[model samples]
Target: MSYFCGSYPIIEKKALAGQIYSYTLLCPQIAENAHIGQFVQIKAEGYMLRRPISICQTDKEKGTLRLVFEVRGGGTDKISQLGAGDMMDIIAPLGHGFTLSDAPNGKVIVVGGGIGVPPMLDIAKKYGENCTAILGFRSFDRIILDKDYFATGARTVLCTDDGSVGIKGTLAAPLKEELKSGAAAVYACGPVPMLKAAAEEARLAGVPCEVSLEQRMGCGVGACVVCACTVIRDGKKQVLRVCKDGPVFKGDEVVF
Candidate 1:
């Protein structure tokens, strides 16, 4: 995919939750070429390494790209403090994304946990009414983009671990039922445990599944082996870079 690296002015900035912030940037080139599930790497102020955030939303006509992130450390905290009109250095549309081509005709299940929920928004929008989203959060306050998913005409099921909202359990609660209804495909992103469970469920249901992995990265590119993940390819297990080889892989291929 074509990518652009440059400084872009923030057009909008808002806090979605307690420590979660959503920043929209005016970068036409990146907005136009970015695919669903792709991510952008932003250079954190005074930090040597960049922070990779998934592409939350994009508007090619408006020349904007949105990124949602939590203030987890000094780098992300620096990003959360920036206001509109602030210019930030970023490399856009890096890493492989989910494949829509493999999606089944009738309905596709999109699952996300915690921060992973943002990337699923674009996929729901792309699939429209044919998409069914299962989002899990730690609690009510952690919930995000529920309205956004509804606006896209996708059926959404929200769950919280603490039983403070919607269904009280893991995403697997709703996911198991969805799989029983039959789906063309399944796509997910979240913590390793959540992903592993979803992958297993998909396998049992005989549905094709894709998962986006999260890892610590020294470089946004594959030059560093920091984000290496083990995958079963062609009957053999091999280590692949999440940044270069894929942040998205077939659920069955991942070694977990």
Candidate 2:
């Protein structure tokens, strides 16, 4: 709930894919308290509202936070123009993040699709060899973070829509395979269809699951009604704000 708002210096920026870029910022205050699934509200120059970007990785000791984002529109296009050495405006760490299990588990599965892939990195990195990451993309060209996931020492499964990469299909097959072996828990973030399927699969498998909802936010914070999603909490349907209530929620609770 506690957050920081400031202009942080961009330490490094790397081009990941065609329109995707990774930025590392020097922000001690934000990095010091950032959690595995929290995000930052970044100010895009010349734009009225800030864009929400997930915290890809955070190094508390080094006082740095990494954000991987794609140039999706005018606001993000402006954000993409900034390079290393520029001061970036950000308010973080915002929203509820994933409730990560403190101890390492031999069986944990993390799923992500397209732009949703970035947030899964933090959990994969933390769980290391104990985690299995099933990542999906439209094609080989759209794929990002394969090497990065592998570098985390987590078992990485790659899937593409065109079969130009690992497996040509959705994450369903592999997810079911992993669950068959028994998973302690499942975590996911991606397109709603994907999230829904993953949540259902985990539910049927009787594995506890958590999912990060990908929502467009006008205020980044809970002030605006822009990011509302209905979820069944306490056996009742309740409207919730993705920015305030969560980007992360228990899988079965999501109405999607």
Candidate 3:
């Protein structure tokens, strides 16, 4: 993957949910090199460290990159205050992404929960009708990109924890049903618990699965060990850096 550190102009910025903000940036280099599940690190105002946000969408022709993030603390709160026309420093197109080479041959299940839902949008767009998206949120107000997923023409399923909207349950219910029918592959990103459950379901079904992990990152690059996670590689357990080795790994390979 190619990595670029530059000041990108914010083409547009808007609030999607209560504390969630979407920002579109004019970063040609990153836009051209970015893959579906790769992420970018933005330097938040007044914060010494950069915040890692996944790439939601990319327009190579237009040279634009889209990111959706939640305002969780002081760093993200500062990011939420920025508006259009502002320039933001970012290091992008980092880490590995999902594999889509075999998607056209058979049914592919794309699952995401809460903030993890955004990255799944580009996958749906690429795989088109072959992808089935299962998105889970805490409630109606936290729901995001429902229309975007529908626009991709991929079969979409939405789940809400409180039963305020869509199905009254977690993503695991629909995911289990999908696996039973048969799936060639599955891609998931969510909380640790949700990912573990999804991984186990896919494993039990004998289907190939990949998961994007979220971790506390100090440096956006591999210089720091903050994002390390235990993974079984070549039958040996090792601590891998999420920023470099992956944010994405084979479902069966992850120790969690």
Candidate 4:
């Protein structure tokens, strides 16, 4: 399908955290086709370039798509201030999603850090009870959507740099415990550092793993190579488009 750029009708907008906002946009076409880990590029104002944000959820029947974003800079700061009745220009359901075709559906491990946890939520919803979610943040105040994740029926583990939540360390620590026990597969999303650590940990445990990467983009779609990333395939270095080939890729194939 051709990439279509249009305005999104906002149905709901609410604060998720201090500067984080959750927007439920009405987009029947994109919602019907969205997959776990896929994202949409949206503009905060008319005539502005779009910023890519991962799709948090999609309800095709309801014609709604959700996105959770924090006010990290100018783009997101403008987004957080948008109201329910506001209209947003968006191009969505872009990029490749998670590869679940070979997923075992048995004892899956998911690790997320900070805002990176949002994309993993859709994955957890699809896998349900078979998945275990491990999340990390700097502190309790920075934590955003734990309760909803717990409601997914996946065994949820929370970690904070400080001892304010479930665990007092990074996700790798508890993830190691799960791997040692017997996790079938591991999926992760987070800052580059956390993902690097998780990839290394997964390698040591000898478990298959996939990671979702977030990068800056000048154009939300594949037309622009602004989000090109390096990956290794069959011992060869290849450049992949985060907007097209994948935001999700096997841990071993990615270059940390």
Return the TM-score for each candidate structure.
0.97, 0.98, 0.98, 0.94
Summarize candidate 4's per-residue lDDT along 72-106 as a digit string, tens digits: 88887877778999897888888888776446846
Residue 220 in candidate 2 has what lDDT? 80
Badly placed stretches (over 4 Å) of model 1 are: none
Model 4 lDDT on a 0 to 1 scale: 0.85
| Candidate 2 residue-wise lDDT, 1-256, digit = tens | 5898899999999999989999999998899999888889999999998999999999999999999999999999999999999999999999899988787354789999999999999899888898999999999999998999999999999999999999889998899999999888899999899999999999999999999987889888789879999999888999999988998999999988
What is the alpha-carbon lDDT for the whole of candidate 1?
0.90
Worst lDDT 10-window in candidate 2: 99-108
Error of 1 at 59 (Å): 1.7
Which is the winner by TM-score between candidate 2 and candidate 4? Answer: 2
| Angstrom error at residue 30, model 1 | 1.0
Q: Which candidate's lDDT is highest?
A: 2
Q: Clash number for every model?
A: 0, 0, 0, 0
Candidate 1 residue-wise lDDT at 196? 95
lDDT of each: 0.90, 0.92, 0.91, 0.85
